[model samples]
Target: MGMMFPTSLIGLSFDRFWKLKCLSSMGFQSLTSLEYLWIKSCPSLTSFPEGGLPSLLLHLSIEGCQKLEKVCKRDKGKEWSKFANIPCVEINGKFIYDPDSHSD
Candidate 1:
């Protein structure tokens, strides 16, 4: 978590956000209250943080992120499971991965 916020942050969106090359492993694992996250037009983005995202996150969308290759691996990496319970996940205007269906 690069910056600590009050335990009340519910939604966050990054539109055309530049300068940051990556969003993962920046301490998002500490955002216990975060429910929604939207990232758009971040062309420089490449991948997620190694530690993974917060557990409370329910919604995630990534659009126009041309450089972003993979949002965590399919079912191997530690960060992969962090997104396993999310209800909605959209990438580039398409609903590709479904985390809930991979549950145990």
Candidate 2:
């Protein structure tokens, strides 16, 4: 994804990208209208983009990406800052950040 995704896109998913390793922050930031993103089965992925995910991102789902999940475990994660603001986040079917359970 090189800032070429349709701006009208609101949801996106990355599935079974076995060779995918990392993504560029700027590339995702350009998705100004993006709301939800899901990634699965990319075992080699270990990190998020450099700066952070788009502020408009409302939901995030990650599965089967053990290395990346380990690096994004709530506040203790090295990439926590990138996900702290997303209202919804699910890792391996676990709710890491759930708006329904969050209190102020």
Candidate 3:
């Protein structure tokens, strides 16, 4: 696990990370109970943790992370498969994936 992520946690918030760069994929996948992940203002972040996110993750939000935002290009993202099962996902204040919002 990196400095911010630990194992078997319920949820975590990544806020205004001015110096954070990258994360290993293995660490976050071990978070069995992790349901929500919030990332904000990490300008230098170019990618998600390498492999994938935890299976139990239900919500994901990304804000002010331009580089990472480009990588997570909606369904075309490099890590799109990792996000497929997630019920909700947001990027730059927009909902990339939200099952409930399609009620129109």
Most accurate candidate by TM-score: 2
Position 43, candidate 1: lDDT: 82
User: What's model 2's lDDT at 42?
Assistant: 92
Q: Is candidate 1 or candidate 3 better by lDDT?
A: 3
Model 1 lDDT tens row, 1-104:
26756667989888987766877554576678999989898887776666667778888888887666354445563445657678777776555465553433
Q: What are the runs in model 2 whose C-alpha is more than 4 Å off?
A: 1-3, 98-104
- Model 1, residue 37: distance off in Å is 0.4
lDDT of 3 by residue, 1-104 (tens): 24445566877888888877766676676687899999999898876766678788888998998888777775687766767778888876668755543222
Q: How well is each residue in 1-104 modelled by candidate 2, as lDDT tens digits?
A: 55567777899899988888897776786688989999999998988889888889999999999889888877888988987999889888878766553332
The candidate 1 region of ten consecutive residues with least summed lDDT is 95-104
TM-scores, all models, native as reference: 0.72, 0.87, 0.79
Off by over 4 Å in 1: 69-82, 97-104
**Can you list the residue pairs that collide in candidate 2?**
none
